[model samples]
Target: MTPPTRPDIIQWIKRAWASLTTATILGGFKKARILEAGQAEHELSHSEPDWKALICLLQQGNVPVQTIDSSKDIKQDDAVEEDDEVVNGVFD
Candidate 1:
């Protein structure tokens, strides 16, 4: 996904149903052990990216300050991509 726009980000956040969007995502970040969380600004979507929200989540955990590029991170997942779309339950 190119990066959700700001408005989309807010919506995504609301849809996510997490009290603290940043805290939750960052908590996941820590659990995932993303050593160098890339610029938290580069949101999941390109247009209306909610980097601000992402930043809050990242702050919840003390992940490495390495800056993990989104593209590179997915490459390391050890999963298969079909038509550029990740197969559901692939990890299972």
Candidate 2:
């Protein structure tokens, strides 16, 4: 079989995105809550099957993925420090 074109992959991704409902997305959050509550074997319902298919297709196509390290973008100077000096005489 021939490889899928760029447009075809985009269409598949679009279909997968459409299949992702609010309930389906919120299911992940619900699972996190369940896990926090020390419950196991919680059946999280995933409504987006197309996303799995799209991922398989991308893996088969050998698509290159770029990863970002957000920590590298952060600097110590960016941290906000509270001022300890009190200006009570100026107000009085």
Candidate 3:
């Protein structure tokens, strides 16, 4: 399969940020690392994309950031993605 486009990666990060809390993002990052390491250890067919680097790009302002208010109530459905699927369950 072809690699995800830049826009795709950006969109995924944006969605993840919006849907997940900071703690959740941290947890996911840990999980992502584990999954990546497993792939490397087994010599998986897919290339291992640098997920932490992608997150760093987000932090460095490659994508626009939005401020959300914790005081206001949000719709549950809107607050999270229907599926918590990451690219290839890690980075595609």
Candidate 3, residues 1-92, lDDT tens digits: the string is 24455577778976655665544544564565523323323221223444565456466544565675545645554454545556755622
Question: Where does candidate 2 clash, by residue pair?
Answer: none
> lDDT per residue, candidate 2, 1-92, as tens digits?
24455577779977866677745644553464422223233333454344464454355446665675556553545533454344774321
- Tens-digit lDDT track of model 1 for 53-90: 55655575553456545565334335453446445944
Q: Cα deviation in Å at residue 4, candidate 3?
A: 0.6
In candidate 3, how many Å is residue 63 off? 16
The number of the candidate with the highest TM-score is 2
Give TM per candidate.
0.23, 0.31, 0.25
- For TM-score, candidate 2 versus 3, the one ahead is 2
How far does residue 70 in candidate 3 sit from its true spot (Å)?
A: 36
Error of 3 at 5 (Å): 0.3
Please tell me which predicted candidate would have the highest lDDT against the true structure. Answer: 1
What local distance difference test score does each model get?
0.52, 0.50, 0.50
lDDT at residue 27 of model 2 (Cα atoms): 57
Which of candidates 1 and 3 reaches a greater lDDT? 1
